[model samples]
Target: MTAGDPGGLDFWSFVELANRRLAEEYGFKHQLATELLLTLNRASNIVTYDLEASVHRPHGLSWSGFRLLFVTWLAGPLEAKKAAELTGMSRAAVSNLAKTLVADGSLNRESGVRDGRSVLLSLTDAGHRDMIEVFREHNEREDEWAGVLSPEEQRILVMLLDKLVTSRDQFDVRGRN
Candidate 1:
């Protein structure tokens, strides 16, 4: 199919074609791993984009911003380093996002009690209210996404994903926290 053709092939079709081509031309093997990783990444991106567009952007938050706010709202007043670890974001990113959130009156940043150079972040009163409202909508969207599968299937998927995540230590792969 031509690359510019709009209705030529769907995603799975493209993946299948690529797999066949790679196997034929490059002697590539590992199709199962390739397919699994591609499907996982695609699903994550689709859900993240949908959630950002439908739930977060209207409230002036990106996925990252919402994530920062979500973690802090649920588990503040936490050090920025802790927030970064929980959010799977870098410490520098947490610092920068905190500045924006603080400027918007949605977060409070204070000096750490034990260390002068450390920053502790917490949601403000308005931040708490906003987070509750936003989280209600967020959870509703999450429910809609999760509704595609049966409860047992969802449980199994979660278990499998957790297993994959926890098994990272078995390999030398470096990934987000």
Candidate 2:
């Protein structure tokens, strides 16, 4: 099976084979699929390690919780739908997590200005301090832990990740099975 000569292939195998064929056909190719999988996996591990090394100790901010919170920090005072879109999480998941964070006093939610139907979300005072502490400790650990990677390497890695995210839209991977 080749490009445009597609045969039966499930999602997993299809992506794998496509990556391989892409390298062979186009040459000097990046393993887009494997790069994506490993990038997510390595990121998860780094976050986990950083969280465990947190100095202030656990404050009910699991990795998933932190994920929701981190997005809020990045694009806060946002409507629920927009937050979900930025985090790449489902609206229901965002809503549910928002409820939990609100109850924990780590998030503040109110009615959206433009959309009466939408709810705006942001970090509460508690959430703000918590996020700052978490990130400070996390960044410290990152600097010490990832010391092997030079500044240029880190910059290159970030550029590659950004490129991969943008490339997904151009791939047209729908209904490839």
For each candidate, C-alpha RMSD in Å? 2.1, 8.4
Q: What tens-digit string does per-residue lDDT give for candidate 1 at 48-135? A: 9999999999999989999999999888699999999999999989989999999999999999989999988999999999999999
Candidate 1 lDDT: 0.92
Deviation in angstroms for 124 in model 2?
A: 1.5
Worst 10 residues of 2 by lDDT: 1-10
lDDT of 2: 0.77
lDDT of each: 0.92, 0.77
TM, every model: 0.94, 0.67
Off by over 4 Å in 1: 1-7
lDDT by residue (1-177, candidate 2, tens digit) is 235545666556667776776788777466875757865877768667666647334655766678788888878688888887777778888989999889999999999888799998999988998898888876787687667789899889889878867888787654211
- lDDT for residue 69 in candidate 1, whole number 0-100: 94
